[model samples]
Target: MGNLDGKVALVTGAGGMRGVGRATALKLAAQGADLAITDVRRDASDLPPAEVRQEWHSIDSVSDEVEALGRRCLPRYADLGISDEIQTLVRQVMEHYGRIDILINNARAVIGRDKVPVTDLEEEVWHHFLDINTTAVFLCTKFVGQEMVRQGSGGRIINIASNASKQASAMGAAYSASKFAVLGLTQASALDLAPHGITVNAVCPGPINTDRMSYWERSQADAAGVSLEEFRAQIVEQAGRATPLGRIAEAEDVANMVGFLVSDEANFITGQAYNVNGGLLFH
Candidate 1:
């Protein structure tokens, strides 16, 4: 039997194949939990804020993979920036599965090229990032927590955070600040939800291998007039030098932590920020 047998989970930010959310969703599904996956890029102009078309298959593919794991999967296009849409997502999941036991808040505003220092950051970018990254977490948790309470079953809530939560990053002031707020929300919600038999925690990952990381490097390379290949190598070397693990983390590394946190083994843990950074930073 799987650890999460008979459980239902909702994973946000799951459309990106190389993203942590996709990994976490698949991992949860592998453990025997039915999945409800969401991604921002469901509608035209989801990211980059430019003209585009809604590609439902982006999320469908994820759900298909989950179903292949022998569990039910429901994928939806979600705009966490809208409170009504957030509520609707919860309702849809509940209608399908009747209950939700695990909620993974993994979606965030990840426009790597748009990052800028606090002094140079535009107000629009700042608010946009905050709306999606920080505010969405609050909305998702608030709505999902209510569902868990109504179900009368204790549940688990895991917030995907970043190394920026604890340390400063170059040209990542807004991102860092947003992640820091996620940590705060995790702790405060854990305290409040503890009485309701719900557990809330945060996972902080550093320099993981993902398309997002690739884009991050490419953006830097462009600014420095270097090839993408050289930029990629430099980043890997820098991550290895700074981290005791001697390399950046893989997507599965973070997923492994998520799997553990949602399992029965971690029943006693809550309100803590666990780092999957391969010892990049110690606390």
Candidate 2:
């Protein structure tokens, strides 16, 4: 049997076809965990106005794949930015799955274009970013922790943070700030949940080739007054130069870290943020 056999996992933001969330969900399923997937669907919600154009429908694809792997999959569309909605979603997961042994807080909000500095960032933008990135983690952990404690089985919370949380850059003010809070929150939650046998950790990823990067590339191309091809080359070159590994990360690399952290092998690892950025930031 797989390490995650008989386990149940809830992965947020698993609706993207080529992103970290989808990759994480697949990894869990392959390890023999029943999956509960949630994604922000296009509807009237407090989340940002636009949704990225996706070539493949990740929501259905991930669910089908999990079921084909001989594990159950419950795919739901929920906005991570909404607190009430998150509570309801967790309630549904408990009712359906009976228990949630693993929670992957993989949802994120982006200010695609219109890069604003922290000083000039609108309150609305900052609040929106925090709502999805940091606040959702708190809400999900609170409810899921309750279920885990009740089940008498310690659980795992693997938050998907980013290197931007520590590094400073233009046009990433809201994202960086919210992720910074996530790292701190992960440590605090790990300490508090230790008594309950629950472990909380975070995976800080650097420039992975996800749909999020595609959007950013287009935006950067426009910003730099260059063709999309040129813009992509420049971005790749810059990242390769900055990273000690001479390349940005792949989605599977981040997924591997998350898979290990959530497994029994990592029972002793908690309240720590592992950097999956290919030696981007060693300090």
Candidate 3:
């Protein structure tokens, strides 16, 4: 039997075919969790071509996959930027799953004008990062933590933070700031929720092999005046030489960390920001 046989896990931003959210949901399900997965509504036009080619249909497909694992899945479409919508999402999860023992705050917005330098960053773009990345996590933790406290059985809250939260890079001020805020919030919430037997922690992944990496690669490629293909090759080779692990991370790598965090073994752990960055940030 899996460690999470009777647990219910709620995962946000789970639509991407090759994303940490999807991978985490699957990991928890494999451990015997029923799932409540969510993603914002998106136009087909906005999908990555490779995912589209694979018929990746966001939360619906994820729900199907979870159900196939012999677990119940409640799929939701929500705007995490709105507090009311988030409350609604939590309520829906409670209604469908009866309890939410694990909450994964994995939704993020990485592609925006916020990718520019701090000097060129717009107010809206900065808020865009805070709303989706930081505020949404806070709101989820708020509602879900309340539920966990009420249940009196303890719970797990895992925020999918980034290496950017620890080490700043060029032209990523807003993204870094938002993730930094999440790191702080993770520690604060961990302290607040610890007395209630709920543990809150952050998983910081760096240079992951996801569609988000493609966007980063494209931006770097443009900046370096090289083809995307060339830049990708350069990064992969450079990562091999620069990082201790000799390679970038896979979504499952991050998911595995999350799986451990929500397990019985992590009961003594809290208020921590774990790096799954291939040893990119040693400090």
lDDT score, candidate 2: 0.82
> Candidate 1's residue-wise lDDT over 94-152, tens digit each?
99999999999998886664466678888887887788889999999999999999888
The 10 consecutive residues of candidate 1 with the worst lDDT sum are: 44-53
- How high is the CA lDDT of each candidate model? 0.85, 0.82, 0.88
Predicted structure 1: lDDT: 0.85
Checking candidate 1 for backbone clashes, the offending pairs are: none
- Candidate with better lDDT, 1 vs 3: 3
Candidate 2 TM-score, C-alpha based: 0.89
- The 10-residue segment with the lowest total lDDT in model 3: 210-219
* Best lDDT among the predictions, by candidate number: 3
Q: Rank the candidates by lDDT, best first.
A: 3, 1, 2
User: Number of clashes in every candidate structure?
Assistant: 0, 0, 0
Candidate 2, residues 64-156, lDDT tens digits: the string is 877888889999888888888988999999889888999999988754532566678778878888898899999998888888888888999
Which residue runs of candidate 2 sit more than 4 Å off their true CA positions? 43-55, 213-216, 223-234
Model 1, residue 99: displacement in angstroms? 0.6
Stretches > 4 Å off in candidate 3:
213-241
